[model samples]
Target: MRYLPIDNQLFVQNRQRLAPLLKSKSLVVVNANDIMPTNADGTMVFRQNNDLFYLTGVDQEETRLVLFPEHPDPKFREVLFLRETSELIEIWEGHKLTKAEAEQVTGIPQKQIYWTHQFEQIFGQMVFEAEFIYLNTNEHTRAGVEVQTRDARYIDAFRQKYPLHHLERLAPLMHYLRAIKQPQELPLIQTAIDITDKMFRRLLGFIKPGVWEYEIEAEMMHEFLRNRSRGAAYTPIIASGANACVLHYIDNSQQCQDGDVILLDIGAEYANYNADMTRSIPVNGRFTARQRAVYDAVLRVMKEATQMLRPGNLWDEYHREVGKVMESELIGLGLLDRTEVANQDPDAPLYKKYFMHGTSHFLGLDVHDVGNKYRRMEPGMVFTVEPGIYIREEKLGIRLENNVLITESGNIDLMANIPLEADEIEEMMN
Candidate 1:
C-alpha cells in the first residue's frame, strides 16, 4: 500500500456492524480481486476488493476472510487466510505479510490466521455447521461484469460440493453496510479530495492553448502519486472543446484550443477511498460570454441540487427535484423553449437534452460506490453533486461537481474550499 497504514479498529468496527445483520449460524466468505492479465507474461496492478478491505483492512493478493459467527469452536468463529511467502516468491514479489503482521493489521487473532494452502481443510471443518453460507460477488448496479471472479468460481464449486447448504448473496448485505461511511473512512476520502484540489490548482497554471489533453492527464497522475494516492479512482475524462459533450470521453488526445473549455471529470484514490470531482475551466484562463453563461447556469443548478442531499430524502424524489431545478436553468440559458418544456411528456423531461446523466451518485471506495438507490438519504452517506450543460451546436460544455456529506443538522460541501465561481477560477489561473 502506497498510503500509510490505517488503524485496524475501523475494520474491527465494520465487522461488529456486520455480525448482527447476518443470518443466524451464517458463514460469510470474501476473496481478494484477481490480478488482471495484460498479455502473455504480463499482468495489471492489483487493487484490493473494496468490500474485503472494508471488513479486514487487508490489502494484498490471494487473501480470504471467513466469518463463522455462530460456530461452536472459538477459533472457527473468525479466520483469515493468506498466501504464504516462499523464498522464490519473496525474491520476485517482495515480502508478503507474516501471520503476526496480518493479526496486527486485521485485528484477527494470530492463532486463527493460516496459510491459503490450509483453507480447504479449515473451511471443511466449519461448513456443515453453517445454516447459511453468504458468498460475495460484484453486485454494483452499474458494474459491467464479464470475466468470472474468484468468488464466482468458489460459488460454483461450493454448490457442487455441498449440494444442500442454503446459499445467500453477500453482495446485498455488503452494499447496505458499505454505502454508509464510517467516521474514519471520511478522512481518507477528504485526503483524496485535498490531493485533487492541489492538482486542480496546479493545472490552472499549466493549462494553455497549445497543451495537449494527455499532458494534463499525465500531470494529474503525477500529482496523485506524489501525494501517496494509488492513482485515479476511475479513468479520467480530460475532454476539451466539443469533446466535453461526450460524457465518458477518455481519448485525451486533443490539443486544448484557446477558446475551448476543458471539462475535467477526475478523481484520486487514497487508501482505497475515492473522491469524485468535476471542474470545467477555460483553456486560456478566461471564459467567453457564452461559456460563462452556461457555466453560471450549471453552477446554479448544482447548488440547488446539493441542498436536497439532506437526510430522509428519497433518491427518486431527489433526482426529480434536481431535474426541475435544471429545467428552470435551461430555460434561463435560452436552450429550451418554455412552451415546449412545459408541455413535454412527464416521462421524458426536456432538460435532459443538455443534462443527460444523473445529478448525483454515492461516492466512496468505488467512484460510483455501492448503495441502494431506493433507500432514503441518511447521515454518513456521501454523494457527488454534478450538473452540466452540453451544447454540441456551439461546441461548448460546462460541468461543476463537489462531494457532499449528509449530516443530522444538514449536508456539508466537502469541496467548498475549492474554487467554483467563474471569477474565482479565473483569478486563480491568472
Candidate 2:
C-alpha cells in the first residue's frame, strides 16, 4: 500500500459496532474484491472490499474475514484468512503479506492466520456451529453492472453449501454503521482533501488557453501520485466550454478556448477514504462577467446548502429545502421563469431544468459513500454539499463542491481551506 499504515483500533471499533447487529449465534463472512479482467490475460489493479476493509483493514486480495462473535473459542471469534505466499509466487508477482506481517497490518494476533485453501473446510465446520449466516453483498442502489465481484461468486457457493442456515443481508447493517465516521477515518480523508487541494492549486498554473484537456488531467495525476494518492477518486472530468455542460463528461480530449470556463470534478483518495471536490475556473485565469454571475449563484447555493447539514434532519428533506434555495438562484441567473414554476409539476420541479442530480451524498470510502439516504442526518455522518447550474444552451456549467461532516452543533467543511469563493479562486488563478 502506498498509504501509511492505519491503527488497528479503528477496525476493532468497527467490528464492535457490527457484531451486535448480527443475529444471535451468527457468523459473518466477507471477501476481498476480485481483480477485474481486461482482455488477453490482463487484469486491473485490485481494490479492497469496502466493508471488509472497514472491519479488518486488510487491503490484499484473496483475503477473508470471519466474525463469529458468539463463538466459545476466543481465537475463532475474529479470524483472518490470508493467501499463503510461496517462493515461486513471490518471484512471479511481488511480495504478498506474510503471516507475521498480516498480524502487524491487522491487529488480529499471530494465531489467527489461516491459509486461503483451507477456507472451505474451516468455514463449513464453523457454519455448522452457527445458526445464522451474515452474507455481504453489494446492495448499493447506484452500483454499476460493468463487472461481477468475488462476493457474487461466493454467494452462489454459500447457498449451495449451507442452504439450511438463515441468510441475513449485511448491507443494511453496514449502511447504518459505516455512515458514522470515526475520528481516525477523518484524518485520512482530511489528508486526501489536502492532497486534492495541492493538485487543484497546481492546476491553476497548468490550465490556460489552447491547453488540451488531457494535459490538465495528466498534471492532476502527477500531483496526486506525488502526494501518495492513487490518482483520482473518479475519472477526472476536465471539461472545457460546452463540454462542461455534459454532466459526467470525462472525454478530456477537447482544447480549452481562451474565454471558456473549465469544470474540474476531481478528488484524491488516501488510505481508502475519499475526498470529493469540484471547482469551475476560466481557461484564461479570469472569469467573464456572465461566468462570474453563474459561478457566484452556484457557490452561494453550495454555501447555503452546507449550513443545513445538521443532526435530526432528513437528507431527502434537506435536499428539498435546497431545491427551493436553488430555485431562487436559478431565478436570479434568469434560467427559471416565474410562470413555469407556478404551473410546474411538484414531483418534477422547475429547478431540475437547470440543476439536475442530488445536491449531496455521503463521501468517504467511496466517492458516493455508503449511507442510509432514507434516514435522518446524525452527528458523524459526512456529506458533500454540491450545487450546480448547467446552462448547456449558453455553454456554461458551474458546480462548486466541498466535503462536510455533521457535528453536534452543525457541520464542518473539511475543504474549508480550499478556495470556493469566486474572488478566492480568481485570486489563486491570477
Best by the TM-score measure: 1
Q: Which parts of model 1 have CA positions greater than 4 angstroms off?
A: none
lDDT of 1 at 231: 91
Task: List the global CA lDDT of all models.
Answer: 0.93, 0.90
lDDT of 1 by residue, 365-412 (tens): 888999999999999999999989999999998889999999999999
Query: Could you tell me which 10 consecutive residues in candidate 2 have the lowest summed lDDT?
Result: 144-153
- Per-residue alpha-carbon lDDT of candidate 2 for residues 143-201, written as tens digits (9 for 90 to 100): 87666678878888888877888888988999999899999999999999999999999
Local distance difference test, candidate 2: 0.90
In candidate 2, which residue pairs get closer than 3 Å at backbone N, Cα or C atoms, i.e. clash?
none
**How many collisions between residues are there in candidate 1?**
0
